[model samples]
Target chain A: MEFLSERARQKLKSALLILSFFVLWEVACLVFKVSEIVLPRPTVILGALWQFFPGIRPHLIQTLYTTLVGFALGVGIGVVIGAVIGVSRVAYDTAYPLLVGFSSIPKVAVVPIFVLWFGAGTTPAILTSMVICIFPIVVNVATGLATTEPELEDVLKALGAKKLDILWNVSLPRAMPYFFASLKVAITLAFVGTVLSETVASNRGIGNLMMIASSNFNVPLVFAGLFLLAGLGVALYVIFSLIERRVAGWAMRKQDFAMG
Target chain B: MMAAKPDTFVPALPPSAPERARPLISLEGAGITYGRGANAVEALTPTDLDIDKGDFVALVGPSGCGKSTILKLVANLIRASRGHVFVGGREVGAERVGIGMAFQNPTMLPWLRIRDNIMLPLKIVEPFRSEFRAKRKTEFRDRAEALLEVVGLKGFGDKYPWQLSGGMLQRANLCRALIHDPALLLLDEPFGALDQFTREELWAILQQLWMDRKPTVILVTHDLREAAYLATRVCVMSARPGRIVADDAVPFARPRTLDMTFEPEFVALTQRLRGLIVDARTGKV
Candidate 1:
């Protein structure tokens, strides 16, 4: 109800921006008489989106399932490997060079290899996402775990804590803020990785649908796909941010106080 | 140097009677060096100490004088370069237990609730560990609550560490250390962060905790009065490559209150330790 409320203002501004964009696009099309195949107006895009909402069922499900599989597998593997590497000096030392190299090589370059290994189906897409979505968690958690302060460690030790006990208590809790810091980045990458991998190889997902729409010069469908991807990204990021806010309450409070 | 007084450097420890219960911890010919040869800095050189059961010992010296190193040696948190550390008459070869420690900064786990932070040791240390989540666990909670009560933090159990003031956090920090009822409580200047009044207030709380718990305490501090008031014996060290210079015992007795700070005996002993630190400062020790 309040005029200056942040959420209301934000929503109002976004609605205005979208409205103006559509208006400009319509005017540009009218003035130039741009072919609909080349550049569709907002109304056409909306119509395509309406059609898409119904026809996208089977493909959307397939794409989403494959994407999520890749994302989850990547996260699972990344966390376990990262924790081991993060905690153990010898393990980290042995793995560091290889991980560094793996991190450097662009994940996009591996699509063909994954395709050859797993075939041009959901497997390849999932594999690509798995490869692409893991690094941030590994890097972030490892960094967080390694750099816990010595004095805290000593206190835990003096309290007669077993090594595992200290790890569970001080090191793990201390690493939480850093974990969430990286998780926010990691989750978004997972989503993107899935979508991109699907785009390259998927048959039923939004990505494949986009490719189909683009090649056929169905501009509204392409715009529809783009808009959906953007929405997904925003939604996922907002969800992760909420989780971060809860898990890292202390860090947020200090930041908020410091900002004020 | 003659042993100054009975109540000064030794507490009335119930377990210390009859059997010569070997000192809670001992440092024998301890030496620590950083680096080697021409570049080596010998941080501590052949230091010896017998911190008695329930005696509050203060290791005070100028910066870089290895005051912290002495506490480390006693805790067995680090190895001595050339000597041995003993706790409860055995080599610190993994059987040593019941050592609670605190540092200058309040190192509470930022994510955990204050109750969880205090209950950490119970969840870690043996006897308490296996039975923690099992047996009612009310005992551990009561123990934490009692310690918090003693530290004047009765209702702050659920609040996170960040939500508390520095003084309150440090009190909770010390409580977490003492929760396991360790025989040797090692405090490295626990009140160094609080204001003057707050620091003095914490000293009284610390004294009462030491009095009630009767743990062998090694408090590393730069404050001479803190050393005098809280410690049974104040061990002064020389600068840089440090060794004990003045090992003076206080003259005051138990049931010591804030009023004792105004007494002549307290003043004289405070002045005496002050002179020893100055003696250490001038290389006069």
Candidate 2:
């Protein structure tokens, strides 16, 4: 107990909470005599996952690959468009309304269009995820750059720095925390976009497997598919969080005291 | 030794020539107005002022007297609606070089280490910028470290801006401003947010930096005591449509100490500056 640091203790508490949640869920399913089709118990879901892991592995890889490819493209395009809109008044005024309008349309609605244009497979899934995740990244990056303190700009401007110099030295670096935050949001959205396309069009990926599982009334397998997706999402989120801590730790430290 | 031909030699100009002794900075009836037409509000009145090289001048008055506006004009951060601003014998334009500025808020880039933040200008301002990459590890880093030491932030170069206290950040802010050895230094109430003890401590640090480097400084502050303590000349401005109403030269010797602030002459000088501001605020000046 003495050897456990505060972070380790906190992590242990989280693990215990998750373990208890599953135990409670398992007990309720048994006591209520709930039908497996209606609500499969945690143990049953785990069993199905262990039994079908080999078959599920390819679908899992498909979804992960689709989401990552889409997310990387989304981040690259988002940052460029965001930097443009953030720095230029003309871009902000002309493009912002259009972007907002486009984002407001349900991403699910756009999946069929993507499938129609690209034909049913990985292409539609990748395209859907790319489109879905770009909005948050663009909005966040633009806001970050637009909100750069005038004082900071003045510090460089007084030294006769050119516009590009200011953008490179100050605006982009200042916008890093905002960019990283959007990565967390966009990463999750990327998964949603991929799955949406996969369920609607693709014959591959976890979403398609879950679709097939539900159609055959394989409740345990469906739950297992969900568990895999959730696990993958959490893994990606954790990776992004670690990267954020490394690059934008200054803003993170400020936020801790700010909350207090 | 061969004797130099008299025809090849050019005689030196007389010292009395106006061009020979022109001020480092000259505002020829310069003024600024916000917006245009019906919505326009005059911030600074058309006024003339001259500052010689290495002069420490403080602009002091009530709030809204546009003291900071004057500094911005000098830095060429904003354009004058009337007349011209000349710095280093050239009219102010889109491109202004050899200027360093610090505000009340310590505007250090949070992502950068203190040393990197101080060396920022070197990566942008020319001559140094041209050779920055080559000398960054040796010459530039040593300069940043030296300034940090001067500001009492020795060995804190690797720390982020947030890790330091408000006072320490402000001290770092001063180090950043002085690191480039700019021809002009503009400070807009840089210690305005600090506690009294911290503010007084910083005053000594700033004075030492200024005395050593001798960059022409224009400090904009509401603190009359600060104006008297640090400046060679204190210019008091009238409130609204700000104009220089009073310009008084401090009769104090160099290497001024904090203890000297308590002297009768220093006290009287600050009191007179305070009185000018009060009158300006009351519309009696």
Candidate 3:
């Protein structure tokens, strides 16, 4: 304990808290003689997950591949569109209302239309995820660009920097922290979108597997699917957070001093 | 070590003969009025001015006197509502280039290291711009580092802008402004945000940079002493519908020291400029 740093101690405390929560849940289920169908214990879920690991592998890979492809496309399109709106008042004024209106429509409502257009498979799932994640990135990147310091712009403008030059040198770099922030939000939403589409229309994926498990009254297996999805979402979120720290470390440093 | 008392009133020197024939910058009845119709606010009154090459001119007055407006007009950051502005014998237009500018805020990009910040202008302005990437690691880096050393910021080039103090950032801002060696430099109260001691120290650093480069400078400031100390000519502007009411020549010699600021003649000159501003603010001009 004495050798542990403050960060290490905090992490240890968090792990202990999570472990205790599972222990309490397991104990309560046993003490109450709760039916496995009503609420599967964490141990039962873990056991089911281990037993079904070989069979679930393909579905897990399918979900991951769909999410990554959709997310990559979303980021590429979002950055370009965001840059356009950010740099031009006309684009922002014209596109902002439409974007707001579109994003407001619950993304789950859009999955059926994607299924109709692209058919019930990986295509619908990928399209759903791609559309779901784009809005946050666009809004964040636009806000970042629009907020560039007028003083900085004047400095470059006086040096005869063209509009393109200003965009490259100032606006894009300034928007990075915002872009990374959006990525964190977008990644989680991407998982939600993929799962929702897979449940509604796809034959393969964690969502479809969970649907089948629940229909069969295999409560532990259903819970296992949920845990798997949650684990994957957290892992992606943490990976994006790490990337954000590396790319926008200056902004993070500012935040650290601000919080202190 | 007291210098002899000098004449209290020295006539403004007409831009010497040949220089007068082709002044570097001339403003003829140029004015600016923001908005349109009834909502319009006249920011600057149409007026005339001429600055010769290598001259150091300061525009000083109360706030909203359009001293900063004049700098913007010359820099072509904003268009004039009336009349014309000529730079290098050509009418100022959209394509004006090769000018250096610094603001009171010390607007360094936080993401860029100090050396890169200083070299930013070179990556845009021509001659250097055409070859900036090729020389970025070698020639440009050396130029930025050399300027850092000159401003007493040696060995701090690798640090980010946020890591430096306010005064150090201002010094870097100055370095950025002078990095390209532009023929014209516009400073809009570049030291206005600093404390008294830091401000004084910057005045020396700025003066050294100005003396060494001798760029035609147009500095907008509220500090009358700063105007008197730095500029070869100090222009006092009227409040509101701003116009230059007086253009007085400073009689100080080149390479002026901080101690010179305490001399009776220097004090008298600042006092006279201060009076002009006070009178202008009260509409007594």
The candidate maximizing DockQ is 3
Mark the regions of model 3 whose C-alpha exceeds 4 Å error after superposition.
A1-4, A254-260, B1-19, B94-97
Per-residue lDDT of A52-140 in model 2, one digit per residue for the tens? 99999999999999999999999999999998999899999998999999999998899888878889999999998999889999998
Per-residue lDDT over B1-285 for candidate 2, one digit per residue giving the tens place of the 0 to 100 score? 112233442333357766656677889899988898999999999989999889999999889888888888888878888987777656765224489999999988888888999999999998899999999999999999999998999999998888899999999999888888988899999999999999999999888888888899999997888888899999999999899999999889978888999999999888888888899999999
Q: In model 3, what are the clashing residue pairs, if there are any?
A: none
Determine which window of 10 residues in candidate 3 chain A has minimal summed lDDT.
A251-260
Off by over 4 Å in 1: A1-41, A242-250, A254-260, B1-21, B135-137, B262-268, B278-285
TM-score of chain A, all candidates: 0.83, 0.94, 0.93
Q: Which candidate comes out best when scored by TM-score?
A: 2
Rank ordering of all candidates by DockQ, starting from the highest: 3, 2, 1
lDDT of each residue in A18-47, candidate 1, tens digit only? 889879998999899988888888788878
Q: In model 2, what are the clashing residue pairs, if there are any?
A: none
In candidate 1, which residue pairs clash?
none
User: What tens-digit string does per-residue lDDT give for candidate 1 at B177-261?
Assistant: 8888888888898888889888988988988888887988899998877888888898889876899987888868875677788
Model 2 bad stretches (over 4 Å): A1-4, A254-260, B1-20, B94-97
TM match of model 2 to true structure? 0.93
